[model samples]
Target: MNLPKIVLALGYSGLIPFFIGPVWLGFSPETAPAWLDRAWLSWAALIGAFMAGTFWGFALPAVQGPAGLLGIFISVALVALTGIAVTLEFAHALAGLALVFMLLLLADFWRERTLDTIGGYFRLRSTLTAGVLIAITWRYLMLPAGGA
Candidate 1:
Protein backbone atom coordinates (compact mmCIF):
# COMPACT_ATOMS: atom_id res chain seq x y z
CA MET A 1 0.00 0.00 0.00
CA ASN A 2 0.90 3.67 -0.32
CA LEU A 3 2.48 5.76 2.42
CA PRO A 4 -0.62 7.55 3.60
CA LYS A 5 -2.63 4.35 3.77
CA ILE A 6 0.09 2.69 5.75
CA VAL A 7 0.30 5.63 8.13
CA LEU A 8 -3.44 5.56 8.66
CA ALA A 9 -3.44 1.86 9.35
CA LEU A 10 -0.59 2.19 11.81
CA GLY A 11 -2.30 5.07 13.51
CA TYR A 12 -5.56 3.17 13.87
CA SER A 13 -3.88 0.02 15.06
CA GLY A 14 -1.92 1.91 17.68
CA LEU A 15 -5.17 3.20 19.08
CA ILE A 16 -6.53 -0.24 19.87
CA PRO A 17 -4.48 -0.87 23.00
CA PHE A 18 -5.01 2.61 24.36
CA PHE A 19 -8.68 1.77 24.46
CA ILE A 20 -8.17 -1.76 25.69
CA GLY A 21 -5.35 -1.11 28.14
CA PRO A 22 -7.22 0.99 30.63
CA VAL A 23 -10.48 -0.85 30.19
CA TRP A 24 -8.96 -4.26 30.70
CA LEU A 25 -6.24 -3.46 33.18
CA GLY A 26 -6.44 0.12 34.35
CA PHE A 27 -9.97 -0.27 35.60
CA SER A 28 -9.28 -3.46 37.41
CA PRO A 29 -5.75 -2.77 38.52
CA GLU A 30 -6.25 -4.91 41.56
CA THR A 31 -8.23 -7.73 40.02
CA ALA A 32 -7.04 -8.06 36.46
CA PRO A 33 -5.32 -11.34 35.75
CA ALA A 34 -1.54 -11.11 35.53
CA TRP A 35 -1.47 -12.74 32.13
CA LEU A 36 -4.17 -10.47 30.77
CA ASP A 37 -2.40 -7.38 32.04
CA ARG A 38 0.87 -8.53 30.54
CA ALA A 39 -0.85 -9.29 27.25
CA TRP A 40 -2.54 -5.91 27.04
CA LEU A 41 0.60 -3.96 27.90
CA SER A 42 2.58 -5.92 25.39
CA TRP A 43 0.05 -5.31 22.66
CA ALA A 44 0.00 -1.62 23.46
CA ALA A 45 3.75 -1.31 23.33
CA LEU A 46 4.10 -3.32 20.13
CA ILE A 47 1.38 -1.40 18.31
CA GLY A 48 2.87 1.85 19.56
CA ALA A 49 6.27 0.86 18.23
CA PHE A 50 4.77 -0.10 14.88
CA MET A 51 2.99 3.21 14.65
CA ALA A 52 6.14 5.11 15.51
CA GLY A 53 8.19 3.25 12.94
CA THR A 54 5.61 3.70 10.23
CA PHE A 55 5.22 7.36 11.04
CA TRP A 56 8.94 7.84 10.66
CA GLY A 57 8.97 5.91 7.41
CA PHE A 58 6.34 8.22 6.00
CA ALA A 59 7.99 11.31 7.42
CA LEU A 60 11.60 10.55 6.55
CA PRO A 61 11.27 11.43 2.90
CA ALA A 62 9.49 14.62 3.71
CA VAL A 63 11.90 15.70 6.46
CA GLN A 64 15.21 14.70 4.90
CA GLY A 65 15.68 11.35 6.62
CA PRO A 66 17.59 11.51 9.91
CA ALA A 67 15.59 14.34 11.42
CA GLY A 68 12.36 12.51 10.77
CA LEU A 69 13.64 9.33 12.30
CA LEU A 70 14.94 11.18 15.33
CA GLY A 71 11.61 12.88 15.84
CA ILE A 72 9.75 9.61 15.63
CA PHE A 73 12.16 7.96 18.02
CA ILE A 74 11.72 10.71 20.55
CA SER A 75 7.97 10.50 20.29
CA VAL A 76 8.03 6.75 20.77
CA ALA A 77 10.33 7.07 23.73
CA LEU A 78 8.04 9.57 25.35
CA VAL A 79 5.05 7.32 24.94
CA ALA A 80 6.79 4.28 26.26
CA LEU A 81 8.34 6.06 29.19
CA THR A 82 5.08 7.69 30.17
CA GLY A 83 3.27 4.39 29.86
CA ILE A 84 5.75 2.78 32.21
CA ALA A 85 5.41 5.63 34.63
CA VAL A 86 1.64 5.31 34.58
CA THR A 87 1.85 1.62 35.22
CA LEU A 88 4.19 2.26 38.11
CA GLU A 89 1.53 4.35 39.83
CA PHE A 90 2.71 7.76 38.77
CA ALA A 91 -0.60 8.88 37.36
CA HIS A 92 -0.10 12.61 37.74
CA ALA A 93 3.31 12.53 36.16
CA LEU A 94 2.11 10.33 33.36
CA ALA A 95 -0.79 12.67 32.71
CA GLY A 96 1.58 15.60 32.54
CA LEU A 97 3.91 13.80 30.20
CA ALA A 98 1.07 12.70 28.01
CA LEU A 99 -0.11 16.27 27.74
CA VAL A 100 3.33 17.38 26.67
CA PHE A 101 3.58 14.63 24.11
CA MET A 102 0.14 15.41 22.77
CA LEU A 103 1.06 19.02 22.32
CA LEU A 104 4.32 18.10 20.68
CA LEU A 105 2.56 15.78 18.29
CA LEU A 106 0.15 18.53 17.33
CA ALA A 107 2.97 20.97 16.79
CA ASP A 108 4.90 18.48 14.73
CA PHE A 109 1.88 17.75 12.60
CA TRP A 110 1.32 21.44 11.97
CA ARG A 111 4.94 22.13 11.18
CA GLU A 112 5.30 19.18 8.84
CA ARG A 113 2.20 20.07 6.86
CA THR A 114 3.01 23.76 6.62
CA LEU A 115 6.64 23.23 5.66
CA ASP A 116 5.86 20.53 3.14
CA THR A 117 2.62 22.02 1.86
CA ILE A 118 1.14 18.54 2.03
CA GLY A 119 -2.50 17.63 1.72
CA GLY A 120 -4.91 16.88 4.54
CA TYR A 121 -3.29 13.58 5.43
CA PHE A 122 -1.51 14.89 8.52
CA ARG A 123 -4.69 16.54 9.68
CA LEU A 124 -6.56 13.31 9.38
CA ARG A 125 -3.89 11.44 11.28
CA SER A 126 -3.83 14.01 14.03
CA THR A 127 -7.59 13.88 14.30
CA LEU A 128 -7.53 10.12 14.58
CA THR A 129 -4.85 10.23 17.25
CA ALA A 130 -6.73 12.80 19.26
CA GLY A 131 -9.94 10.81 18.96
CA VAL A 132 -8.24 7.69 20.23
CA LEU A 133 -6.73 9.51 23.19
CA ILE A 134 -10.07 11.03 24.04
CA ALA A 135 -11.77 7.68 23.81
CA ILE A 136 -9.18 6.13 26.09
CA THR A 137 -9.50 8.81 28.74
CA TRP A 138 -13.26 9.14 28.61
CA ARG A 139 -14.25 5.53 28.19
CA TYR A 140 -11.69 3.96 30.45
CA LEU A 141 -10.50 6.53 32.95
CA MET A 142 -13.96 7.89 33.56
CA LEU A 143 -15.25 4.56 34.73
CA PRO A 144 -14.96 3.41 38.29
CA ALA A 145 -11.71 1.69 39.14
CA GLY A 146 -13.22 -1.79 38.85
CA GLY A 147 -16.62 -1.76 37.36
CA ALA A 148 -18.35 -3.33 34.40
Candidate 2:
Protein backbone atom coordinates (compact mmCIF):
# COMPACT_ATOMS: atom_id res chain seq x y z
CA MET A 1 0.00 0.00 0.00
CA ASN A 2 1.03 3.59 -0.55
CA LEU A 3 1.40 5.13 2.86
CA PRO A 4 2.35 8.71 3.54
CA LYS A 5 6.07 9.18 3.29
CA ILE A 6 6.27 10.27 6.93
CA VAL A 7 4.50 7.19 8.17
CA LEU A 8 6.61 4.93 6.03
CA ALA A 9 9.77 6.59 7.16
CA LEU A 10 8.82 6.54 10.84
CA GLY A 11 7.58 2.96 10.78
CA TYR A 12 10.73 1.60 9.21
CA SER A 13 12.86 3.92 11.27
CA GLY A 14 11.36 2.44 14.41
CA LEU A 15 12.38 -1.03 13.26
CA ILE A 16 16.02 -0.10 12.94
CA PRO A 17 16.98 -1.17 16.45
CA PHE A 18 15.08 -4.42 16.22
CA PHE A 19 16.71 -5.29 12.91
CA ILE A 20 20.18 -4.10 13.73
CA GLY A 21 20.57 -5.72 17.13
CA PRO A 22 20.12 -9.35 16.14
CA VAL A 23 21.72 -9.15 12.72
CA TRP A 24 24.77 -7.52 14.25
CA LEU A 25 24.71 -9.65 17.37
CA GLY A 26 24.55 -12.84 15.37
CA PHE A 27 28.03 -12.10 14.10
CA SER A 28 29.64 -11.16 17.42
CA PRO A 29 28.79 -14.15 19.55
CA GLU A 30 31.80 -13.90 21.82
CA THR A 31 31.68 -10.24 22.76
CA ALA A 32 28.54 -8.45 21.69
CA PRO A 33 28.13 -4.73 22.13
CA ALA A 34 25.93 -3.44 24.95
CA TRP A 35 24.16 -0.90 22.73
CA LEU A 36 22.62 -3.57 20.46
CA ASP A 37 20.74 -5.26 23.29
CA ARG A 38 19.83 -1.96 24.95
CA ALA A 39 18.70 -0.51 21.63
CA TRP A 40 16.33 -3.39 20.96
CA LEU A 41 14.60 -3.18 24.30
CA SER A 42 14.62 0.59 24.40
CA TRP A 43 13.24 1.08 20.93
CA ALA A 44 10.56 -1.55 21.46
CA ALA A 45 9.33 0.03 24.67
CA LEU A 46 9.68 3.50 23.22
CA ILE A 47 7.44 2.64 20.30
CA GLY A 48 4.95 0.97 22.60
CA ALA A 49 4.86 4.08 24.74
CA PHE A 50 4.56 6.28 21.70
CA MET A 51 1.59 4.28 20.44
CA ALA A 52 -0.02 4.30 23.86
CA GLY A 53 0.33 8.05 24.08
CA THR A 54 -1.33 8.44 20.72
CA PHE A 55 -4.19 6.18 21.74
CA TRP A 56 -4.71 8.14 24.91
CA GLY A 57 -4.92 11.33 22.92
CA PHE A 58 -7.49 9.87 20.55
CA ALA A 59 -9.53 8.29 23.34
CA LEU A 60 -10.17 11.51 25.20
CA PRO A 61 -12.56 12.69 22.48
CA ALA A 62 -14.27 9.31 22.34
CA VAL A 63 -17.13 8.48 24.63
CA GLN A 64 -17.24 5.59 27.09
CA GLY A 65 -17.07 2.47 24.95
CA PRO A 66 -14.94 -0.47 23.96
CA ALA A 67 -12.31 1.73 22.40
CA GLY A 68 -12.17 3.98 25.41
CA LEU A 69 -11.97 1.07 27.82
CA LEU A 70 -9.21 -0.45 25.76
CA GLY A 71 -7.47 2.88 25.74
CA ILE A 72 -7.52 2.86 29.51
CA PHE A 73 -6.14 -0.64 29.48
CA ILE A 74 -3.44 0.44 27.09
CA SER A 75 -2.42 3.24 29.40
CA VAL A 76 -2.17 0.89 32.34
CA ALA A 77 -0.26 -1.60 30.28
CA LEU A 78 2.13 1.10 29.16
CA VAL A 79 2.95 1.98 32.72
CA ALA A 80 3.55 -1.65 33.63
CA LEU A 81 5.62 -2.26 30.54
CA THR A 82 7.67 0.85 31.04
CA GLY A 83 8.47 -0.26 34.55
CA ILE A 84 9.16 -3.80 33.41
CA ALA A 85 11.38 -2.65 30.58
CA VAL A 86 13.56 -0.74 32.98
CA THR A 87 13.83 -3.10 35.95
CA LEU A 88 13.49 -6.49 34.30
CA GLU A 89 15.57 -8.29 31.70
CA PHE A 90 15.48 -7.50 27.99
CA ALA A 91 13.42 -10.61 27.22
CA HIS A 92 10.84 -9.62 29.79
CA ALA A 93 10.84 -6.09 28.43
CA LEU A 94 10.21 -7.40 24.92
CA ALA A 95 7.27 -9.40 26.17
CA GLY A 96 5.87 -6.32 27.87
CA LEU A 97 6.41 -4.33 24.69
CA ALA A 98 4.44 -6.95 22.77
CA LEU A 99 1.58 -6.72 25.27
CA VAL A 100 1.40 -2.95 24.87
CA PHE A 101 1.21 -3.31 21.09
CA MET A 102 -1.46 -5.98 21.44
CA LEU A 103 -3.60 -3.68 23.53
CA LEU A 104 -2.94 -0.71 21.28
CA LEU A 105 -3.93 -2.67 18.19
CA LEU A 106 -7.08 -3.89 19.91
CA ALA A 107 -8.05 -0.34 20.79
CA ASP A 108 -7.41 0.80 17.26
CA PHE A 109 -9.61 -1.96 15.85
CA TRP A 110 -12.53 -0.95 18.03
CA ARG A 111 -12.07 2.79 17.76
CA GLU A 112 -14.74 4.88 16.05
CA ARG A 113 -14.10 5.96 12.48
CA THR A 114 -13.24 9.63 12.32
CA LEU A 115 -10.95 10.21 9.39
CA ASP A 116 -11.22 9.40 5.71
CA THR A 117 -7.93 7.51 5.64
CA ILE A 118 -7.80 5.14 8.57
CA GLY A 119 -7.14 1.63 7.36
CA GLY A 120 -3.56 2.34 6.45
CA TYR A 121 -2.65 2.98 10.08
CA PHE A 122 -3.78 -0.49 11.01
CA ARG A 123 -1.95 -2.00 8.07
CA LEU A 124 1.23 -0.22 9.03
CA ARG A 125 0.89 -1.35 12.63
CA SER A 126 0.21 -4.97 11.73
CA THR A 127 3.32 -5.18 9.63
CA LEU A 128 5.48 -3.25 12.08
CA THR A 129 4.36 -5.21 15.12
CA ALA A 130 4.82 -8.53 13.40
CA GLY A 131 8.35 -7.61 12.44
CA VAL A 132 9.06 -6.32 15.94
CA LEU A 133 7.70 -9.39 17.68
CA ILE A 134 9.55 -11.72 15.35
CA ALA A 135 12.81 -9.88 15.71
CA ILE A 136 12.59 -9.66 19.48
CA THR A 137 11.50 -13.29 19.83
CA TRP A 138 14.33 -14.36 17.57
CA ARG A 139 16.74 -12.46 19.75
CA TYR A 140 15.38 -14.20 22.84
CA LEU A 141 15.65 -17.60 21.19
CA MET A 142 19.19 -17.06 19.94
CA LEU A 143 20.56 -15.75 23.18
CA PRO A 144 22.74 -17.95 25.43
CA ALA A 145 21.44 -19.54 28.64
CA GLY A 146 20.98 -16.23 30.49
CA GLY A 147 21.57 -13.52 27.90
CA ALA A 148 24.20 -11.87 25.72
Candidate 3:
Protein backbone atom coordinates (compact mmCIF):
# COMPACT_ATOMS: atom_id res chain seq x y z
CA MET A 1 0.00 0.00 0.00
CA ASN A 2 1.75 3.11 -1.16
CA LEU A 3 0.84 6.49 0.31
CA PRO A 4 1.70 8.36 -2.86
CA LYS A 5 -0.94 6.66 -4.93
CA ILE A 6 -3.63 7.34 -2.38
CA VAL A 7 -2.78 11.00 -2.39
CA LEU A 8 -2.80 11.15 -6.16
CA ALA A 9 -6.26 9.64 -6.25
CA LEU A 10 -7.61 12.15 -3.76
CA GLY A 11 -5.95 14.96 -5.63
CA TYR A 12 -7.59 13.88 -8.84
CA SER A 13 -10.89 13.85 -7.08
CA GLY A 14 -10.62 17.60 -6.66
CA LEU A 15 -10.77 18.09 -10.40
CA ILE A 16 -14.34 16.88 -10.43
CA PRO A 17 -15.56 20.08 -8.86
CA PHE A 18 -13.35 22.22 -11.06
CA PHE A 19 -15.11 20.96 -14.15
CA ILE A 20 -18.53 20.98 -12.54
CA GLY A 21 -18.40 24.48 -11.12
CA PRO A 22 -18.70 26.24 -14.44
CA VAL A 23 -21.58 24.12 -15.62
CA TRP A 24 -23.26 24.25 -12.25
CA LEU A 25 -22.99 27.99 -12.20
CA GLY A 26 -24.54 28.02 -15.69
CA PHE A 27 -21.25 29.25 -17.15
CA SER A 28 -22.69 32.69 -17.63
CA PRO A 29 -20.49 35.18 -15.88
CA GLU A 30 -22.62 37.90 -17.37
CA THR A 31 -25.69 36.62 -15.54
CA ALA A 32 -24.08 37.17 -12.16
CA PRO A 33 -22.87 40.52 -10.88
CA ALA A 34 -19.16 41.15 -11.31
CA TRP A 35 -18.40 40.64 -7.64
CA LEU A 36 -20.39 37.42 -7.39
CA ASP A 37 -18.76 35.96 -10.47
CA ARG A 38 -15.31 36.83 -9.24
CA ALA A 39 -15.95 35.34 -5.83
CA TRP A 40 -17.31 32.11 -7.30
CA LEU A 41 -14.41 31.71 -9.67
CA SER A 42 -11.93 32.39 -6.89
CA TRP A 43 -13.42 29.72 -4.70
CA ALA A 44 -13.40 27.25 -7.58
CA ALA A 45 -9.73 27.96 -8.23
CA LEU A 46 -8.93 27.50 -4.57
CA ILE A 47 -10.54 24.07 -4.59
CA GLY A 48 -8.54 23.06 -7.65
CA ALA A 49 -5.28 24.26 -6.12
CA PHE A 50 -5.97 22.42 -2.88
CA MET A 51 -6.62 19.26 -4.85
CA ALA A 52 -3.26 19.54 -6.57
CA GLY A 53 -1.55 20.23 -3.27
CA THR A 54 -3.17 17.25 -1.63
CA PHE A 55 -1.83 15.01 -4.37
CA TRP A 56 1.73 16.20 -3.93
CA GLY A 57 1.60 16.42 -0.18
CA PHE A 58 0.76 12.74 0.09
CA ALA A 59 2.92 11.67 -2.82
CA LEU A 60 6.20 13.22 -1.72
CA PRO A 61 8.61 10.54 -0.50
CA ALA A 62 10.29 13.00 1.83
CA VAL A 63 7.09 13.34 3.81
CA GLN A 64 6.93 10.79 6.62
CA GLY A 65 5.68 10.17 10.15
CA PRO A 66 3.75 13.16 11.46
CA ALA A 67 4.01 14.90 8.13
CA GLY A 68 2.01 12.15 6.48
CA LEU A 69 -0.65 12.52 9.11
CA LEU A 70 -0.72 16.23 8.48
CA GLY A 71 -1.28 15.63 4.81
CA ILE A 72 -4.27 13.46 5.52
CA PHE A 73 -5.61 15.99 7.97
CA ILE A 74 -5.36 18.73 5.39
CA SER A 75 -7.15 16.62 2.82
CA VAL A 76 -9.97 15.91 5.24
CA ALA A 77 -10.16 19.52 6.23
CA LEU A 78 -10.49 20.56 2.61
CA VAL A 79 -13.32 18.12 2.09
CA ALA A 80 -15.10 19.42 5.17
CA LEU A 81 -14.58 23.04 4.23
CA THR A 82 -15.85 22.46 0.73
CA GLY A 83 -18.83 20.61 2.09
CA ILE A 84 -19.71 23.51 4.35
CA ALA A 85 -19.34 25.97 1.52
CA VAL A 86 -21.59 24.05 -0.82
CA THR A 87 -24.13 23.26 1.85
CA LEU A 88 -24.56 26.89 2.67
CA GLU A 89 -25.67 27.80 -0.86
CA PHE A 90 -25.88 24.70 -3.03
CA ALA A 91 -27.04 21.57 -1.33
CA HIS A 92 -26.87 19.63 -4.59
CA ALA A 93 -23.26 20.60 -5.04
CA LEU A 94 -22.51 19.39 -1.57
CA ALA A 95 -24.10 16.07 -2.41
CA GLY A 96 -22.10 15.78 -5.59
CA LEU A 97 -18.83 16.53 -3.81
CA ALA A 98 -19.70 13.99 -1.15
CA LEU A 99 -20.14 11.31 -3.81
CA VAL A 100 -16.83 12.15 -5.41
CA PHE A 101 -15.02 12.26 -2.08
CA MET A 102 -16.49 8.95 -1.03
CA LEU A 103 -15.43 7.28 -4.27
CA LEU A 104 -11.93 8.71 -4.00
CA LEU A 105 -11.60 7.55 -0.41
CA LEU A 106 -12.74 4.10 -1.40
CA ALA A 107 -10.14 3.95 -4.13
CA ASP A 108 -7.47 5.09 -1.71
CA PHE A 109 -8.50 2.47 0.81
CA TRP A 110 -8.33 -0.25 -1.80
CA ARG A 111 -4.86 0.83 -2.90
CA GLU A 112 -3.38 0.80 0.58
CA ARG A 113 -5.09 -1.82 2.64
CA THR A 114 -1.89 -2.58 4.50
CA LEU A 115 -1.24 1.08 5.16
CA ASP A 116 -4.24 0.97 7.43
CA THR A 117 -1.55 0.63 10.06
CA ILE A 118 -0.38 4.14 9.25
CA GLY A 119 -3.69 5.80 10.23
CA GLY A 120 -4.52 6.99 6.72
CA TYR A 121 -7.04 4.33 5.73
CA PHE A 122 -9.44 4.51 8.64
CA ARG A 123 -9.32 8.24 9.03
CA LEU A 124 -10.06 8.83 5.37
CA ARG A 125 -12.92 6.35 5.43
CA SER A 126 -14.49 8.01 8.42
CA THR A 127 -14.16 11.42 6.88
CA LEU A 128 -15.65 10.28 3.60
CA THR A 129 -18.55 8.65 5.42
CA ALA A 130 -19.22 11.78 7.37
CA GLY A 131 -19.24 13.84 4.21
CA VAL A 132 -21.70 11.49 2.55
CA LEU A 133 -23.98 11.47 5.56
CA ILE A 134 -23.95 15.21 5.71
CA ALA A 135 -24.79 15.47 2.05
CA ILE A 136 -27.68 13.04 2.33
CA THR A 137 -29.03 14.80 5.36
CA TRP A 138 -28.72 18.14 3.65
CA ARG A 139 -30.58 16.86 0.63
CA TYR A 140 -33.47 15.63 2.74
CA LEU A 141 -33.45 18.61 5.02
CA MET A 142 -33.93 20.91 2.07
CA LEU A 143 -36.80 18.90 0.77
CA PRO A 144 -39.29 20.44 3.15
CA ALA A 145 -38.05 23.87 2.21
CA GLY A 146 -38.70 23.35 -1.54
CA GLY A 147 -35.30 21.98 -2.44
CA ALA A 148 -36.47 20.33 -5.61
Candidate whose TM-score is highest: 2
* Candidate 1 accuracy as TM-score: 0.51
lDDT of each: 0.54, 0.69, 0.48
lDDT of 2 by residue, 110-135 (tens): 55354123547777877887887788
- Return the lDDT, model 1, position 140: 40
Q: Which candidate should be chosen as best, given lDDT against the real structure?
A: 2
* Candidate 3, residue 10: lDDT: 79
Q: For model 2, where is the 10-residue window of minimal lDDT?
A: 110-119
Ranking by TM-score: 2, 1, 3
How many clashes does each candidate structure show, in the order listed? 0, 0, 0
Q: After superposition, how far is residue 91 of candidate 2 from its true place, in Å?
A: 2.9
Of the pair 1 and 3, which is ahead by lDDT? 1
Please give, for residues 1-148, the per-residue lDDT of candidate 3 as tens digits.
5447756587446444334434434555346454542354345435523542554445355246654555565456555655554555454554554554554455455434422344454565455455444534533453336554
Better model by lDDT: candidate 2 vs candidate 3: 2
Worst 10 residues of 1 by lDDT: 85-94
Question: Which should have the higher TM-score, number 2 or number 3?
Answer: 2
Instruction: Note the residue pairs that clash in candidate 3.
Output: none
